[model samples]
Target: MTWTAPEPTRVGEPLTGPERPMLQGWLDWHRRTLLTKCAGLTADQLKLAAVEPSNLTLLGLVRHMTDVERVWFRWRAAGDHTVGSPYNSADNPDGDFDDVATADAEADLARFEAACADADRAAATLDLDHEFATARGRRSLRWVYLHMIEEYARHNGHADLLRERIDGVTGA
Candidate 1:
């Protein structure tokens, strides 16, 4: 039997909380928003491209975001150089989005969830002020949270369109 992506359990973003909790909550909400967009779609549907000349698909977005989480949190923020991105490389820079047609949607979704979990774990011990070097110079854990939130927000919008395109389902 083919694996199926499960519906995400989305929680309301905490309107009142500490700096860390609020950031984490908002990030989690956005993450779930992405998964929720993909939920209830079949593997073939998940792989359907938005239109001609565009490789953007729900599965591709999931795969791309999984690597984004791993890269920022596990690698850069936590300073773990050994942990490499699951998708993308020098030869296949667009693997995350370009290589989704034959990809396993369920496995990719699980990978996204696992990456998020690992990101949370990697960030748990760090202070918001903790800094890490990147190609754009040094940045802080606080910046990582804000950046991830922004990244997800942008992609979630694309996901919303992709989901609606796939089936007439709409609404957040």
Candidate 2:
């Protein structure tokens, strides 16, 4: 049997809830939104850029967001300073985007899922006001959550455009 990517299950963001649940709901919604945009795409299709001279792609976005989730949630927000991003280095800072032409879309998606799960575990015990040290100084867990939501929301837009360019599919 041929292997195919499973369809993404998108859950709507809560219109009314407590702050934590609401924030998490929105973040999860945006995360799934990105994957939904990539549904039914092949590996090459996942690597298709929106335009010339740009490294942006749905797979790249997924890998990049995986890095983002690991960095912010596990390392920064949870105060686990030992972890480092796999997609970045001094000499290869754009590895997530630049290296994605050869990315394994299914494995990349699994990496994203693991990152999100780790992020949730890391943040489970912390209150919204919990503080952690970063290069820019102290920041609250709330800030991290908000920043991640913004990150996914922004990248999901790029994913939308890439998806549309790939097959003319639109409307989230």
Candidate 3:
């Protein structure tokens, strides 16, 4: 399925498609926005822990957001299809990045990218007005897409700081 969005990027710009405030437009914009937040960084820079007390690394955020996208869209929205086990286990809410070894960096990133791809594909085909029930109760796919946009937009702000602190680069 193809993306039906009208925007080129999620934030600070108009897009190159048929003009409309469609669901795909918002979701695609947000998707691009989230991915852009992670652009222009080395694997090491992405793993920076500059603030010590802060777990505010770009890589950490990627892993966490990937888990979030998976749970909300794939697991909950898709009605319990397996996309691997939940990243958050009984004793590990941060399991997404809990074992961030230098050796595993590539694999972890691949996982995140794959998750995003899966989400894009699902969203392209899934109905925006469809309802999905979860522990939080049923929600429209409209809610899910907007929620994802909110989730990534918020974290991308944090990513700007982490990236800037790492290398002084910033922007949407």
Candidate 4:
């Protein structure tokens, strides 16, 4: 079946489940929370390239997270965590950082939403205890979940500063 990408998320709290997750679910929650920080800005705002050749921006982070989602669950996981994608070639793949020029605010938000949806599905469907081979070799699905959460959280911090610099907003 063809998977049309998810639309950009609404600007608000994440749509949560009735009972909260133990660990994996919590990781998923944090990832969504991080993305919410960039929720309402325009593509030009989201793609605001840093001064003096720095490649950092909210749009770059969105693409990188999509790469991370694909890397961890789609490409790296084993057993219950079956990974997949909506796109075939990531093209230069390095475009995650270098291609910010192509970022349409709506498009970037759509990419982030799609990644979040796939990640939510994987976290729900996977066996947390399942082992996956990584560059670190034999990492459990739980580790991947937590690592991605941490990764997203760290990027969100960077995003917080970037967003503030783009406008005048502040606070986490």
Best by TM-score: 1
Model 1 lDDT per residue over 1-172, tens place = 6555688899998999799999999999999999999888889989999755777999999999999999999899999989876778999999999998788888889899999999999999899999988887999999999999999999999999998888977777
> Against the true structure, what is each candidate's TM-score?
0.96, 0.94, 0.77, 0.74
Candidate 1 lDDT at 126 equals 95
Q: Which residue pairs come into collision in candidate 3?
A: 7-15, 8-15
Model 3 worst lDDT window (10 residues): 1-10
162 Cα displacement, candidate 1 (Å): 0.4
**lDDT string, candidate 3, 19-132, tens digits:** 224545665666566556566555666667755688667677777877877877787777657765435677876766664545244565667778878876776567777788
Residues 65-117 of candidate 4: C-alpha lDDT, one tens digit per residue: 87678667766763334454333345664677677776565666676668667
**Which 10 successive residues of model 4 have the least lDDT summed?**
2-11
Candidate 3 RMSD computed on C-alpha atoms after optimal superposition onto the true structure: 6.6
What TM-score would candidate 4 get against the native? 0.74
Off by over 4 Å in 2: 1-3
What does the lDDT come to for candidate 2? 0.86
On residues 71-128, what C-alpha lDDT tens digit does candidate 2 reach at each position?
8988888878887876778899989888987677888888888888889999898999
Which regions in candidate 4 have their CA more than 4 angstroms from the true location? 1-20, 51-53, 78-91
